[model samples]
Target: MHIFVKGAAIAFFSLAITACSSNPDDGFTGKESADVLYSDARTAMETGNFAKAARTLEQLDSRFPFGAYKDQVQLDLIYAYYKQDSTADALANIDKFLKLNPTHPDIDYVIYMRGLVNMQADSYFLHDLLNIDRTDRDPQNAQEAFKDFNRLLKSYPNSKYAPDAQKRMQFLKDRLASYSVKVAEYYIKIDAWSAAAVRGQTIVETFSDTPYVERALEIMVQAYGELGQNTLKQHALEVMKTNFPNNALVSQR
Candidate 1:
């Protein structure tokens, strides 16, 4: 009887192991070739099925680390990650690709994509398209996008993406300067006149080309006036008038 029980237990254990090995939910064990996987991912992406594309690309990467389409796979992974709003993964994968293939012929495109990812991460769509200024926020992503765009322009002056990168870089700079102006305005509201004046002055010095310069100069005017700094106020007003003549702000003062 005991021998019969042991035999039955052994049979159950063996079947369990086999079942576990053959389980579909165990892990990724695709039998498809790398080319097929790549094609599927591409098709999914082209159809706006980004989630599936990201998953399939991830699996393809794992299945064929050194395949013929390895580099393109990495680039596609970045795009998939970006489309999925996975900014951390997108940036990380882009960095990985750059480190692995420093001399890649499409380095310009990679950098452009990097800038695009960061710009998207900035979440400035409303501000960029609608002109709805919301500058009282963090500018970390904008700063990163600015750096990436600037790097691309410097490295690939004649790149097809150069003009767009330059435009985006300018947008980021303007956004950052606008953020400083908002900070200054907040400081003014809290009666931190000195700090407000400093931010305003910094904007005028660093981002003179941005429209925020006008607002920043206005901040300086208000902040210095609050601090009873007549001379500095007059100086800022003169600068504002010189730069933005026919400005309603100067006329109001």
Candidate 2:
């Protein structure tokens, strides 16, 4: 009886170890071939179950790193991450795809995806939904997104995504230009005339195409006047007149 009990205990321990050593694909809950896993992941993604898709794709990648569909799986993972609003994951996968398949036929789409992921990191939802200004918010992510879009356009000018990327880039420029104007206004409020003038000058020189250029000129005029620089103030006023002749401020000049 004692010998039988000991043997039973040994067998139970061995089974537990085997289970532990098995592929722990959490979503799958059982070991499955890469093709089956990939098919499951594709179905989940098509149905908009991005969270499930991400989990299954991760399992497929782990179980079969050298699978026939490895490259395509990684690309699909990027899309899944984006749909899940997992921007960090999406960007990481995009980097991997770029490095591994620099000349992939769908490289333009990958570049477009990178821009979309970064764009979501700093969306204009608040401004669009609530009419709230985002001028005081950090524009770092916006700048990153702009660079991403610019890279796509520079590399694939005729890409189907180029038109939308261009529009997004212009929107980012406007947002950044407005942010600069807001900073200059803040400086003006604090009586930091030189700093205010510098901020205003940045907008005028760097983002001349944005609508905030008019407001930037006003900031420059005010800052120069506060700093007792009459010549600079006159120069700003002349610029306003040249660009916005009908503006009341220009009329006053």
TM-score on alpha carbons, each prediction: 0.81, 0.84
Lowest summed lDDT over 10 consecutive residues: which window, candidate 2? 124-133
Candidate 1 collision pairs: none
TM for candidate 2 is: 0.84
Number of clashes in every candidate structure? 0, 0
Candidate 2, residue 8: Cα displacement in angstroms equals: 58
For model 1 the local lDDT of residue 38 reads 88
Candidate 1 lDDT (Cα, 0 to 1): 0.86
Top TM-score: which candidate number? 2
Q: Scored by CA lDDT, what does every candidate get?
A: 0.86, 0.86
Question: Which pairs of residues collide in candidate 2?
Answer: none
- lDDT tens readout by residue for model 2, 95-178: 989998999999999989988898887875435444556768898888888998999999999999999999999998998998
Candidate 1's TM-score: 0.81
Q: Over the stretch 1-253, how does candidate 1's per-residue lDDT look in tens digits?
A: 7567666766766875674345243134589899888888899899987777878888899989999988998999998988867899999999988998999999999999999998889885434444455676788888989999999999999999999999988888888998888788789889999999999999999998888888888888888998899999999999989989887878887
Task: Provide the global lDDT of candidate 2 against the true structure.
Answer: 0.86
